[model samples]
Target: MFNIDKNKVKHANLFAAGLALGTVGLKVLTSKDAKKVYANVVAAGIRAKDSIMQTAEKVQASSGSILADAQEINEKRRQDEALFEEEESDEK
Candidate 1:
């Protein structure tokens, strides 16, 4: 007696149908309008990234200036303390 599995044949047919559908889907996805939309979306993303980078640069510059001012203030305080010590010692 010869025997064949019907279930395996059914699975193979379904797999082939899925592959065909997948090829058609790829063609639809790569159409002209789809490519333009993709390009615009990417350009917008780049612009957003550039804007964020500019803001970050500005913040970094401001922080650096603030740190410089703080250091200057600290130096002035040290100088004032030294002057006070000298004045006390002169009086004594």
Candidate 2:
């Protein structure tokens, strides 16, 4: 815990005033420069998004192939199990 005197409140006000002044000065001096930097950032973001979409499509294709192969393997296993059960029943 911390304790402070009410009379010391002037320092807080002074700090706020300095922060506001600095913010206004930065906006006035760098507005144009900030715009150019932001434009480049947006363009790069767009390119990254396109690449992500392409990668997702390739992943989807590969997943589909893997799923199909698994289903085929499962069907063959089921058929083999059925044949094994039939032979056991005949011997009994």
Candidate 3:
């Protein structure tokens, strides 16, 4: 007479259930519908990236313009200061 442990039987049943669920999950993930969803997600991500890059380019261009304007203003200020100094020296 063979004695089967109840705990062993319960464990075996649980293992079988887990295996079945894993197989079904694999099948669903590999289905055509899932593939289409994945493709759409990737396409959307690419579009978002392009939009962000365009915005970044615009910002970079604007920053360069701002830096050039600042430099021009500083140069003008320096020239005015030099002229004022020359006038003061001529009077002394």
Candidate 4:
């Protein structure tokens, strides 16, 4: 007493068969092309990453230089202020 609908079962089987055949055919047809496309994509990604890394390094170096220059200016200002205060005290 299997309460299965015969038509529905037939339709399901046909769908499964078609899907399997299509997948196999596509893989056979495009495996080589897929590999080549994948390689190209990987190469492009590597190049993009390398370029970004170089730009980041350049930005870091420039920021360091800017910070060093600011520190030098601050130190010079401090020294000048100290000398001026000393001169005023001597006058008094």
Candidate 5:
């Protein structure tokens, strides 16, 4: 009679269990209910992306307006400073 190794038998059992689990997992993941869940997740992601894009557009528009106003204010300040300098030079 040949002697069997306990460690080899234990490893073989574990390997068989892992293979069975993998096959079942693959089937469950490819089932109809899983497909529906995936579709819903993708649809939700699309809606979220649309909402974020709209908010970003609004923020971009607001920033552009703010930048224009700031530039106008700086231009006015520069003109006023030039006028004051001209008046002081005339008085001298």
Candidate 6:
């Protein structure tokens, strides 16, 4: 037989608590009310995830348009600078 060590009293207490919780968890999980609550929580989580994804998609689409507009602005600026340099050369 294995001898009980007094030094592991804290570990023993935790183990007992874990076992008690496991038993209670089993009972709670088996109950119909707990199952309904768990199902609702899962559904809510899914809905929240879907909402977040939709917002992210909207942000992504707007950012793409903003980026395109910025590039267009930069292109126009470059072309205007080149035209101004050509005008200065003609003046000289």
On residues 1-92, what C-alpha lDDT tens digit does candidate 5 reach at each position?
97999999999999999999999999999999999999999999999999999999999999999999999999999999999999999999
Candidate 5 vs. true structure, TM-score: 0.89
Between the candidate structures 5 and 6, which one is better when assessed by lDDT? 5
**Model 5 segments beyond 4 Å from truth?**
none
Clashing pairs in model 6, backbone N/Cα/C closer than 3 A: none
Clashes of 6: 0
Give the runs in model 4 whose Cα sits over 4 Å from its true position. 5-30
Candidate 4 lDDT over residue span 1-92, tens digit each = 88999999999999999999999998976899888988999999999999999999999999999999999999999999999999999999
**lDDT by residue (tens digit), candidate 6, 1-92:** 98878779889999999999999999999899998999999999999999999999999999999999999999999999999999999999
Model 5 poorest 10 in a row by lDDT: 1-10
> Pairing residues by index, what is the TM-score of model 4?
0.68
* TM-score of predicted structure 3: 0.77
Instruction: Evaluate model 1: give its lDDT.
Output: 0.97
Clashes of each: 0, 0, 0, 0, 0, 0
Cα-based lDDT at residue 5, candidate 5: 100
Give per-model TM-scores: 0.76, 0.71, 0.77, 0.68, 0.89, 0.75
- Best-fitting candidate, scored by TM-score: 5
- Which residue runs does candidate 3 get wrong by more than 4 Å? 1-14
Worst 10 residues of 3 by lDDT: 1-10
- Tell me which of candidates 2 and 5 scores higher on TM-score: 5
Tens digit of per-residue lDDT, candidate 3, span 1-92: 98999999999999999999999999999999999999999999999999999999999999999999999999999999999999999999
Instruction: Give the alpha-carbon lDDT of every model.
Output: 0.97, 0.94, 1.00, 0.97, 1.00, 0.97
lDDT, residue 18, candidate 6: 100
